[model samples]
Target: MLDNTKRQDIKVILQQVWGYEDFRYPQAEIINCLLNKQDTLVIMPTGGGKSLCFQLPALLQPGLTIVVSPLVALMENQVQQLQQKKIAAGLIHSQQAKSDRKLIISNLTQLKLLYVAPETLLTPPIWEKLLQPDLMINNLIIDEAHCIVQWGTTFRSSYTRLGVIRDALHKHKQNKITIAAFTATADTLTQQTIIKTLRLKKQFKKFVINPYRSNLQLKVKTVWTAKGRKKATLKFIQQQHNKSGLIYVRSRKASELLAKWLREQKLNTVAYHGGIINSKRRAIEQDWLTGKLPFVICTCAFGMGIDKSDCRWILHYHTPELLPEYLQEIGRSGRDNKPAIALALISEPTGWLDNEDKQRSQFFTNQLAKQSKQAKKVFEILPSQGNILDIIKEIPDSELALGILQNLDLIQWQDIFNYQKKSSNKNINSVSTSQQTKQMQQFLQTKQCRWQYILSAFSFIKEAKDFKCSKCDRCSLEKPSRIISNK
Candidate 1:
């Protein structure tokens, strides 16, 4: 519990800094836990005010807060927002100039908040700098904590090595550093992975808020062909003209194609994906934020850490490969407490397109499994220290393999993309990727209310009886369906 003086101080800061009169549900309690130097895991939906849970506590604490984030854009956005509040904050990413990065590093002791990508933080220069005697890092925050589980094994192995960082920091500072992890989506498996991989303390506080948003209407439409899929999407866009929204596709090419098609229809739109340069990505985000671009066709890379509150709709041109991803994407809408719609356009199975999605899922799983073997082989032959280019000759996937080995403590990175082998002969498994894919496929075909199905899948049960969210297509008979003909 917060004492009267501390509570009063929190209120003053809330009003002065963020202009919020009071804390949202559970925010105050979360802050109190952190103030008392407790480790905590916060599972709140996007737009549920998770940032304040850590930000306010950092302000109240005595030392600096290190935030580990996944994307460069996310870190930059956060640092800019904190700076706007007159807080001393900075970020280190690949795009920053050498002089700018050095200045930021030298000023770390004075900063209230520092956001960094895991890959950059684990490198020698930054890690060594953080361990210096001058800086006092009181809190270690993992934002989008689900990535630690979802990407730890395959996509970004840097996340899996965070537990080692905590241990190293403890040894260097001679004190236990408090940690707080926050994410919008995580199932039982993902949660367990986060706990075990991060090696969080046993007494760490856990908060799992139900991710139900009554203001967001969820629906799915089935189209029989590629042309039909396009027509259905266009119809939705036509109906919602001039309203700001997002269209999520599965690939960069698709995003570009969709954006081009929408442009031909005389709608203001843009394409966003990893393939776009950082400066252009920043511009597109700004355009969307300022209502210049009414809609953006993008891959899953678009919405993390973006705080656009008035987004009225989100259309999924292709269903995501996981339920957690689907939830995270749609959660971006209705942040301002206004009504919004989340619609997915799915293609009905035709002889030509049958099992296309399932095949894609299996192909990705097979690739991950193959990478595990490659990682083991590379581990066998890697030198005590070497350049990345040399190792890539022996194993084409050495970059990802090195990350996996580093997480297992079999290797230590010396500089950016360079590693030294610490031990040898470790076995790694690609955990249940296929199962996750199947779960997503199940979601697309389920007859149950979409929200209820999601709740059940995430192990959040509010009532013993079946509950239907009447806002979804399955439960609402009043909502009309739009089917585009194959012709």
Candidate 2:
């Protein structure tokens, strides 16, 4: 608990800085926990004020607060907002010029907050600078921490190595550093992965706000063909009369094709995905934010850390491979507490008419299996114990493969750069890749309220047990007609 004087100080800063008179439920407590030097994990809904929980405390404390984020867009979005408020904040990523990063590093002690992606943070230039003797650091925050669990084993391998930041940085510093992780969607297994991967202390406090949002209505529609799916999505968007939202697809090709088709229909939108350059991606995001663009046809790359309220709808051109992803995508809607709709389009039961969803799911499954085999082969070529940095010089993707091995409990890092293999016969990819697909399919076919199914899938059992939402498609008296018609 915060003392009244400390509490009042927080309120004054809040009012003066962000113009919020008081903190939302548990936001104050989260800030207090950080102030008291307690390690914390916060699982709050999107738009539920999670950023403020750490940002406010960073302002209240003394040394620099290093925020480890997963994406450059997220870091830039946050750092730009902090700059607009005239706060002493900066971000470092691969996209920035070397000279700019050097300037930021030169003034590290002056910044109240520094946002960085894990991969960039672990690189030599940034890592060496942070290890300097004069630098004074305080809190280390992992924003969008769920990415550690979701992407660590594959492309974003640096996430699994984040636990090293605390121990390695603390060795040269006198003051103890605390860590706080914040995310919107993490189930029990995901929560454990985060705690274990980040090596959160056993005493760390976890604050979970129920993820149920009453203002967001959920719906799923079955389409007989890919053409019908696009038609249905177009119909929904046309009905919105240019309201702000997003159309989520699974691939860059899909996003581009959909955006082109929508434009042919005279809908004003653009495609957004990782394949595009950073400058164009940022411009598209800016256009959407300013309401110049009504919506964007994008992959998962577009949503994290985007601050857009009053987004009236979210349409899934293809069902996601996992439930957590679906939850995170839909979370972008109804952010301002206004009624918003999240509708997912899936193929008919047998997928005989349109196998897009089935094909996409199978592609990912095969990819995961291939990666598992690659990791095992990489593990075989490794010495009994050695440095990862050295191995990476000789072996391509050794870091990613090692990360997958570590995730599977076949290897352990002795320090930031060193690892020792553990004896194990457990098959790589033993963790069920299809379980998520199965769960997502169940969500589409479930007869219960959509919100209840989501809550249950996310391990919010108590919330799901008696959950009854009057707004979801399952609960609403009205029903949507089938997407295909006999002509």
Candidate 3:
């Protein structure tokens, strides 16, 4: 029941302001949902027109659309772009000047949109204003929704206060003020967390477009050392030119070290981790957008709202612990329909005291990485490479141990390298534990359909009108494969 005339009205506004016509597949559905004044959750892939889904809905709605975000630099960049289009927009994060924010608040009722960080959403006056419909109040939006999960390191404690944001807005409007939460990476668990934290109803509809990118080829290489991984990364970049990419690592030190190393080899690149100041990060991001830099080697902190659509290489120099995060990072590339590749260069756990233990997993415990400290040392005892029995003898309880290391990137599986029955019927250890280990290893070495494996895990498939990648290793080796229905 989406009205086509409203879309044309939006297209005319878009052309006059932002210059665009027509909506991408899910955009109209999102717009129609927002129009219905419902509380909605949008699970979509990166570059699937997520910003437009919220932007156009904000424009068509009667009052202002207040967006709650966590990325500060992203807010400034997006607000500036909208302002250039002559759209009435404002940003009210903590970093803004006093007078500027005052002006924005004064015109809140009349402005089209306002981008505020979670910090601002907690202010007393901000909440007081929201309690009145006379102020700019039509819809409430929260971006980067996965951060709300209870087990997220990226989690913002203030996000738990959003139940107040909605409560105040609803107190005034005779109608239920519309609410929509959007994210490029969130599983069913995280999705449920979003609704619970925001305190919405089971009746709230869900729009989950499965996590699948057709034009991407997934590959994992088991290197023996950090030195080996670096060599592989440089060689791949040399083979592909005029193509953009992302390289992720566990430590800020690693991010800096790799950028310096890549530059030493004459590749134009920069390091981007959360440790940098906001202004510097903004400057670096601006340069990347304008083509001044070729690659960004970053920690997990980068790429929240970046709109780079032409990146072709997404490299994980180390194996990422969480599969969903890995999915999000690699999905950043090949967004423009060109062939892209995700390479995870990895090896077994080294008997060394690396700083990885301090960087991640402080707040969250992934399924693959939940075990006791004694069990984890088994990773070192198993040696860099070993068979299942070899692993079990060292740890004695590898089911718990191996899962921890796999989630922590201390060990990674590269295909079902080999399997042999020791006794006449020892059987291939077809128990659930072995099956899980086998599957995890398979993900490390899958060469079938590029997008099917990941989506299948989450019960998602690809669409017919999606971008296709004929040059990917899988597509090159086989006929086109049909991913299941994402809807």
Best by TM-score: 2
Find the 10 residues in a row with the least total lDDT in model 2: 478-487
For residues 432-456, write the lDDT of model 3, one tens digit per residue. Answer: 2233234444566666544555665
Off by over 4 Å in 2: 478-487
TM for candidate 2 is 0.96
- Tell how far residue 391 is off in model 2, in angstroms: 1.2
Name the candidate, 1 or 2, with the larger lDDT value. Answer: 2
Candidate 3, after superposition: displacement of residue 479 in Å?
A: 4.2
Q: Give lDDT for model 2.
A: 0.87
Write candidate 1's Cα lDDT for 152-176 as tens digits: 7677877866766776777678555
Worst 10 residues of 3 by lDDT: 415-424
lDDT (Cα, tens digit) per residue for candidate 2, span 426-470: 887584457767888899999888877877877767667756777
Candidate models: Cα lDDT each: 0.82, 0.87, 0.67
Each candidate: how many clashes?
0, 0, 3
Give me the runs in candidate 3 sitting further than 4 Å from their true place: 1-8, 150-155, 172-175, 349-442, 445-450, 461-487
Give the candidates in order of TM-score, highest first: 2, 1, 3
